[model samples]
Structures are given as C-alpha cells and as structure tokens.
Target: MHATHSSGKGRGHGGGRGFRGAGGWQQADLPPADDAAAWLTGRLPDDWFVGAPTITVDREEIVIIGELAAPEGSDDNSAAAAAQGRIGRFREETREARMQIADEAEARYGRKVAWGASIGETKAIFTHLAVPAMTRLRHDERRVLDTLVDAGVARSRSDALAWCVRLVGEHTDEWLTGLREAMAEVDKLRAEGPDL
Candidate 1:
C-alpha cells in the first residue's frame, strides 16, 4: 500500500558557498539538503515501509527510520521478539538496496546515511556512522567526565561526555526544539538578505 509520511520536523540551515577540505568536508561547504525528505520519499520503494521514513540529518550523517507493520498472532509478551525478527528480516532483505541508496545519498548530500526499521515496540538501526566530535572542556568540565568514569557510570571520559550530552538532550528537548526553530528563522532572514 502507498502511504505518505514526513521525514521529521524541518529545520533550515544557513546557505552559501563554502570551501572543501582534503579528505574531509567542512560543515560550511556541505550542500543544504532541505529536500532530503522529499527525495528519499520519492526514491524509496513504495512497498518498503508503511509510511515515509523519518529522516534526521546532521553535518556528518543522515538517519532514516521507517515503520513496518507488526506481524499478526503476536501476543504482548512476544511482540518485541516478533518485531525484532521482522526488523532483522527486513534488514537482510534490504541490505543491498539500502547500500545502493546510501551510496547515492552520500554522493548527493556529502554525509553518511544510516538505516533503521521499527515494528511494534522494537526499533533497530542496521547501520550507523560514529563520527568523532572534537570538543575542548575546561578543567571543571573534564573533572565531571572523569568522575563519571571513576564511578563506573561510563568507561571513559569520552563515554561520560556522550552520556552527559544524551542526558541533556533527553531533558531539554523542548528547549532545543525552540532553539532550532529560532535558528531556522535566522536562516530564513539570512537567505532574504542581499547577495554578497
């Protein structure tokens, strides 16, 4: 069945010509993928998902998560297992097609593409990119990560820092949404400005 689904909440980013780096790409140089959702929706096979996948884009990666119909005859206790089986089957069946699409998307967007599928209560990300993010923390901030490592909450400072970021993101989603909206507005205003 043909279904219409959205990528996710759209957020606009600044647009302009930027310089590229050797072996790596600068965020400024990356092409704006404002139409990524529409593109994927059109490119993906109609029978692959119940609806359009939710596509999330960042400077380094693009994640596409799609929902699959849950298998029948699954009880509450077995739902997760059934969903997992369905997800695994989908992954194996779609691997070749997904890779081809990822290749095309990466070439077009200059960012890695990851795929995920969800059915019932289970969601599985088949492939993902782990791009290192460099950050400099003050002594106090560094100590906080060290403390987490020492407390066995994380394996290392990097893990601790990632944990902290996820925690903050989970708690401040609403605030972050507002911030993104404001940034989108700024991008809109900037785009309306004179050509330089």
Candidate 2:
C-alpha cells in the first residue's frame, strides 16, 4: 500500500483553484496539509513509497521536504536499479503535475512553491549566509553555542550558531515581515505627520 503525509504552516486567503486529490479531487477553500499530501500522493504511481513531508513557507517560496522509497519487493540488484530508474522516470513524468501543485499551493498561500525529495536517507542541505568578518559574540552567546554543540545539532560552535540563526529565521519569518512593515509605517508617519 502507498501512503503519504504532509505538514505545513502559513497564512492563507479564503479561496483557491481546484487541487487534485486521491479520489475525485475537489475544489476546496484553503486545503489543509493533509489534503495537499493526499493530492501529491495521488499524483505518484502506485509503486512509490512516499514518506511524511515537511513544508515551509518563506517570503516567496514554499519548500517541501520528504523521502521517497523504491517499490516493494524490489530487493534484487537488477530490480533495485530498475526501481531507481522508475523513480527518475516518475519525477520526469510528474514535472507538470508538480508545477500544478506548486501553482495551487502558491495561490492558496500567496507564495511561490518549490519542492525537493530524497530517495532514501535524508541529508542536510546547506546554504551559505554572509556575516560581517569582525563580529564577536558575548560570553553568554558563546555558552549557547557550546550548548548546541553538546546537543549534537552541529559539528562545531560556528555551525551551532549558524543553526541557531537559521532556526530563529525560520520560526520568526512572518513576525519579522510584520515588524518591517510596522517600522516602515512608523517612518512614514514620522515623515508625513504634522510638524510640531
């Protein structure tokens, strides 16, 4: 049996276009994460093993992370290769379907959407973040880095700090945006308000 799961967090408008689902596939208002997962599962072939997906919404993008497995009973070497090949073919064949899903997700959440999958084991994907060269951390901040290292979330103190920064960025994205807008409004008011 094939099953899929998905989880996502974001703000949504009331209406969106029809999203394809496992059965008849229906149009709904603000389709939840489970519905999205079912829709994606329906698009995949019967042989694929799709794991639970973690979805994240950034300013302009929705990211989907999940694991995919080869068809069951394909343990032999040749069968394993064939299964891998079929997985690749599935990805190619479903390109348009993926785009459709992305479009629907973007419309529903008001953001662009991109997806990435891992065939088996999930590995960390890294992106570089630039910071000032002369920056220094306080003693307490250094202890926090040490704690993260002790927790094994990162390989080193620098990595631990980077992970912490990334976590903060992910969790506070919407709040940061709202803060920026509020600041912009405050600036406008300061400039345009009646001079004392």
Candidate 3:
C-alpha cells in the first residue's frame, strides 16, 4: 500500500527516495507467501511456482534463492522458475486474464518470443496503428485469422501475429463499421471451436 521509488541505477532525473502514503502501489510489495498459495491455481501450473513462496519486489534485483526440496529431485529446472516469476507479477484478474491471452498468443504464435522487448515492439505496433479487433472483421473475413490459428501454417508466433496485423491493415474501416457484432461473432466462434 506504499511506494518508495525503486533505487534503480543511473540517477538521471528522478533518482533516489521519494515516499508515497500507504495508498500507493509497489510491484515489490506482494502478498504474503500464504497469500500467493492461490497463485498455484493460475495458468503456469502449481509446481512451476518454484519455491511456492510469497514474493516481494525490491532491490535492483530480487533474489528467489530457493528451489524445491523435492524428494525425487525433479524440482530443479528453469520451467518452474519461469512460471513463478511470470505468474507472480499479475496484480489482478484483468491483468492476469490479459496475461493469459497474450501468453497463449505468444505460445501458439510466438513460442520463440524470448524477451519482453520483442513483445513490447509488437505492442507498439498496435499502439501506433489503428488495428482491428474481432468485432471489426466480417463474418467471412474472421475466417482468415481463424484459418491461420487453426492451420498453424504460420509456424512461429511472430509469423501468425504479422499475418493478422496485415489483414487488419488492409481493411481497417470495414472492421470498424460493426465492431461489436463482429466481436460477438468471433467470440462465439472462439467458444465453439478454434479458428478454421
């Protein structure tokens, strides 16, 4: 409930301690270990939560210094560490849900997406351009994205992403006309099955 400016290096403009009242938010100030127990129920799967301990976000880098004390010694691996680190950062259901969507998109379309920068660049594309949502596309055109999603012909995630964006770029206004209905149709298709 409080924020003390993170003393990250390079004291350029805003360097050093500034305090906020208890109503502030700090990424490092996470729920207690027990509070994070439900983090197991999140997408990454339970064992992947690494130590399954609560997390706090401070220091230039916070160290999660423990691995599982599994009797079978199967606990030491990067996968679990990655999950805990990934899932621990979600602050609410909306963020967690968005993360889930992005994660799925990354996984299916971008398994090779290594760092945040790449994902961020993709985000920047959407930020700068007027991209279309499912609602924007025609009933038949939605087939394009679905087809790509289904065939998996795009192979890597980036390829799939670029294809969808390209489709949007070609018909931005068409999509904008009946966005709500389009979205509903797409959502229904999504619920019913994967893309064609």
Candidate that scores best on lDDT? 1
Which runs of model 1 end up more than 4 angstroms from their true locations? 1-26
lDDT of 1 by residue, 1-196 (tens): 0111253212122223232321122455787777788898899999999988889887778899999988999888889999999999999999999999999999999889999999856898987987677877999999999999999999999899889989999999999888767766766777778776
- Determine which window of 10 residues in candidate 2 has minimal summed lDDT: 1-10
Residue 71, candidate 2: alpha-carbon lDDT = 55
Better of 2 and 3 by lDDT: 2
Off by over 4 Å in 3: 1-20, 23-44, 49-51, 59-66, 69-196
Better of 2 and 3 by TM-score: 2
For every candidate, C-alpha RMSD to the true structure in Å? 8.7, 15.6, 22.1
Q: Against the hidden reference, what TM-scores do the models get?
A: 0.84, 0.36, 0.17
lDDT per residue for candidate 2 within 76-126, as digits (tens), equals 666656555655665676678677777777666655666665555432222
Query: What is residue 145's positional error in candidate 3, in angstroms?
Result: 61
**Per-residue alpha-carbon lDDT of model 3 for 117-192, expressed as tens digits?**
0111111111112223223557776566567777976754445667766677587856654664564465456557
C-alpha lDDT score of every prediction, in listed order: 0.80, 0.55, 0.37
Measured with C-alpha atoms, the lDDT of residue 146 in candidate 1 is 95
